[model samples]
Target: MNNAHYELQDGIAVIRLENPPVNGLSYELRRGIVDGIKKAEADDNAKAVVIIGSDRAFSGGADITEFNTPKVMAEPTLPTVINVLDSTELPVVAAIGGVCMGGGLELAMGCHFRIAHPQTQVALPEVKLGLLPGAGGTQRLPRLIGIEYAMNLIVSGTQVPAAMFQGTPLFDELVEGDLLESALTFAKKVVEEQRPLKRVRDMKVSHPKPEAFFLWAKTSVGAVAKNYPAPLKCVEAVKASIEKKFDDGIKLERELFAQLIQTPESRALRHAFFADRAAGKISDVASDTPTREINKVGVIGAGTMGSGIAINFLNAGIPVTILEMKQEALDRGVAHIKGVYEGRVKKGKMTQESAEKKMGLLSTTLSYDDFKDMDLVIEAVFEDMGVKQKVFETLDATCKPGAILASNTSTLDLDKIASFTKRPEDVIGLHFFSPANVMKLLEVVRGEKTSKEVLATSMKLAKKIKKTGVVSGVCDGFIGNRMVGKYQTEALLMIEEGASPQQIDKAIEKFGFVMGPIRMADLAGGDIGWAIRKRHYEEKPDTRRLYVADRLCEMGRFGQKTGAGFYKYEPGNRKPLHDPEVDRVIEEVRKEQGITPRKISDQEIVERCVFALVNEGARILEEGIAQRASDIDIIYLTGYGFPVFRGGPMLYADEVGLINVERALQKYRKQTGNPFWEPAPLLAKLAAEGKTFN
Candidate 1:
């Protein structure tokens, strides 16, 4: 009874949905709604009816938790309750506010008329969960808004403001304030003027060329959807409106919804959604740990990484101070930021005024003297530990006592950097991915002496900057790059055994990688891997080492930036072109090693690269460096361009079976005699037992 609040005033029945926190359509709430509508229809005092919510949001959608439970899916259906609301003789008006999504929007479409607040937004986001709208949404939305707009909304799962609905015949009226009062006024107008009620399902499809719309939709959604089945199913639901009768279309939608609910893509996408929400939870760090409120930040470098990090802070409305040793370098960094903003403006992502406002937040200087009173300072200089340590030492003396100190070191030791600081507990690692502003993953490394307050503050700051922060204990390469190193080394060894760079690249790309390891190295610059390789050789000299490809770097053939590396690049175009010189260099290296390279199959190449990463991930999990397998999956999907449709490397491995992965590793170990091919003990044990990472 509490879920539904009913009152009769002046021969008008007002029914309000009272479920708190977005008013998700739960089982009890549905039953209460059906009973309330029947009571209003039978009462002589009630001449008409109005349905709305008590507070700001009308409804956020169906209770997502309900999908995980068996009771809701197995018990009394949602359609039965929806039919009760739709069939009532009295006129029913939905007064919507805030977000009306999923089943909430379906309920609104069932009403005779909809009155929305000016700021209200409506969407059916079922596609995000790999399900189509089940309860008359796919059938009704097209009827009310037409095919094109409806298809776009369903496919993208994007919401629009109520203002866009203005001048549209679907909405009866747009209300400004006090949604209940506006609903009552509209209800009285309908009764006094004897207005005819219009149901969305009863309306016919409206389009000049219905077949052309269907053809265009199939082509557009198919291109973007790839292996995912939800987008194409959404198109089928829309096409059903034109091809089938109203009730028949609803039946088709229900059938498709049930089928999609059982797909592996749906389960994976839903798992990802829940995993993202769960990533914010940190049990070791107290919830109330005091955070250093960062209103202004200072950056110690003006290179690519530094500029990209500055753009992230500026976009979040935090003022930034960038410092470079040379004035020319400072000018270039500023120009790069401006160019990025101008491109965004041209694409209508931002207005010129908005771009200027963000730019105004940035301040540049050549010395540390201008960094006074800054709440946080991020050092994004070279990869050398000595350079980073020197920056930490300078920042320790320059920054205020309570300010947070962070280093953007991808592979350097955070504990070593903390050792140089007077307040070692305040130092942390904020490893932003390359092209920092665009990449969503941020590895927040906690040094051995890192304080709980520092960890909590970094997590909160990641949310403020709109990035996914995964807390990682300090180790070599933290989480992502540490696993990446194992995978990349295996790929290079494959090349030594006669797999061409193109073959390796093509194999992984077919397996759903956005780019192969060799091409990624090209884009990141060949010098980066060469430098890291040199450092590794210095630290662990006894390990079997691959011959260095120094000619590429010595000739200034860095990568796409230098127009050549593993592959040749045309100016202004980043596409890879084969070069015989690179192949000749590789052949010479193979000859020096006394290795007779043979032709490698595509399947062998994919398993070597991807399984290597998954095998390393298992090691990380056993060592407790990563909290969960899903955490690694989220990191790869967001940062390393692992295809989302395939889930992630870990998920993909699970799909392929753990035993198969172990067998592949064993086969490689026997063939190559490389110690790195030794299947992780955990992986071998799990595979033997037929268990999975989950």
Candidate 2:
């Protein structure tokens, strides 16, 4: 009696789901729904039953926390609750308003008819979390929509707008007004006309050759999924619907869902999903801090980094003023911005009109007078302390009072940049990844004197620009590039010690990196690394040198732009063309170091490259540069091209076991005699105690 809310209107039974916030189908809500259906079935006066939700959303999905609990997996689960809705003899109509996802969609599918408002979103996003539709979703979706569309939706886990279902058989009617009134009207029409019940499971599979569906799905599964078993397993579950009986398909889906829940990929993906959400919560900053609203922004550079940062602000509907010293440089920057926007237009991502509108948001100027009244100024000049300090001093003198000052320094010190300005409290780092408009990770560096207000304002601006803002303390390379330098150094050393560049690249590529170390270095331009190395040497000449490869840069082999670095590249194609010249250079370097060439295994190469990064990440964590291990994972997954299926470096380390990693590092340290291979103390302690980063 407590579970069901019975209301009689005319001769119809009204059952409203009384749960809050998307009506997540918890254990109590499931039982309440079942009892509501039973009440409608037993009432003689109720000619029809109309089920609706009081909240904006019908239901979000099954409770995520319930998945780990034992009580949920027992008898009378979600499937049983769906069965009660399916068994109702009277005409039943479901009124859906907001999000109807997962179990919410399953409940609507069981109804005799469904009506929804124009703003509702429908999806089965279980595949994103490494799961398939368990409660009749696999069996019913294909029956409502065809096999091809159903497979794509379930496999990709994409949500579609409710307007797309207009005039489709999936939804009975698209309501413009109240969802309940529409449901009631539809129910009255159905009862009066004595509409026949159409069960999804009873519908025959529409494909002419069902075997072809399985074959195509299998091909797609192999190409996209590679070694990961979850996506392929999802394909198999969907295939069951076309190949087997409805009940058999449901059983296969359940088995696959249960198996995937225990997989490393699923666990890692779930961790990543929640980690991204958790990054927004900062304990240091009060929620009440006044966010410096960024309307008009200024970028102090015209190079690649500055132009990309300006593009992001423009794309976000914020006006930008790109300041450069020379008219020729300003013209080149404008041309580059137009080219980038034109590429987007060519790909059908944006229209020509929209591109022109975005370009109109940008105003190029040569003087700091144009920066007046700007809300934020981001300095993205060359990585030099004097050049950066000059820009900061100029910005401090010209910018509007209380305007947030940001620097886009990848590895330079933020505290030193703040030292040049009188308002050190306002100076913060907004280190966007290369090609800032495309990359999602934005390292928000907080200097020693950076105020909490400035930190909060920087994060707010990062979110506004559609970037994941990860806060980091001041360090040489901050968090990402610092760890990357160590990883890249290890890969280069491996090449010096007889490992082939292609072999090393292939090993890590197999481990889910988009490209290997040498290939990535080539793509990012060798000049950048050369510049950083030169700066490092100039600043501290006596600081332990680790055999630099100056020959590559001297020969003008500055990666893909110059067509050669550690590998050769063809114009217009990203594929690496192995060069005999590079091999000769390696041989000459190897002789200079007096190293005997030895064969290197793929296993050893992967361990050296990946574990080196993980080891450095541990050091960053120990130094308090990174707040959490998950934050490091987020940076790699979003910023770097680290594969999502394996999670990030930290997750991979946990999977490999710290003890095994520490042993490898110790063995390599002794063999190579490189101080960089010294395992981090936290890594050693974790290995000794047999613990994980989590």
Number of clashing residue pairs in every model? 0, 0
- On residues 512-577, what C-alpha lDDT tens digit does candidate 1 reach at each position? 888999899899888887888878889999855655255567667778988998899998999999
Candidate 2 segments whose C-alpha is farther than 4 A from its true place: 1-23, 26-32, 35-56, 64-76, 194-196, 286-289, 538-548
Clashing pairs in 2: none
- Candidate 2 local Cα displacement, residue 195, angstroms: 3.5
Q: What is the lDDT of residue 293 in candidate 1?
A: 86
TM-score of 1: 0.94
How well does each candidate superpose onto the true structure, as a TM-score?
0.94, 0.93
The deviation in Å at residue 310 for candidate 1 is 0.8
How displaced is residue 518 in candidate 1, in Å? 0.7
**Candidate 2, residue 17: how far the Cα is off, in Å:** 5.4
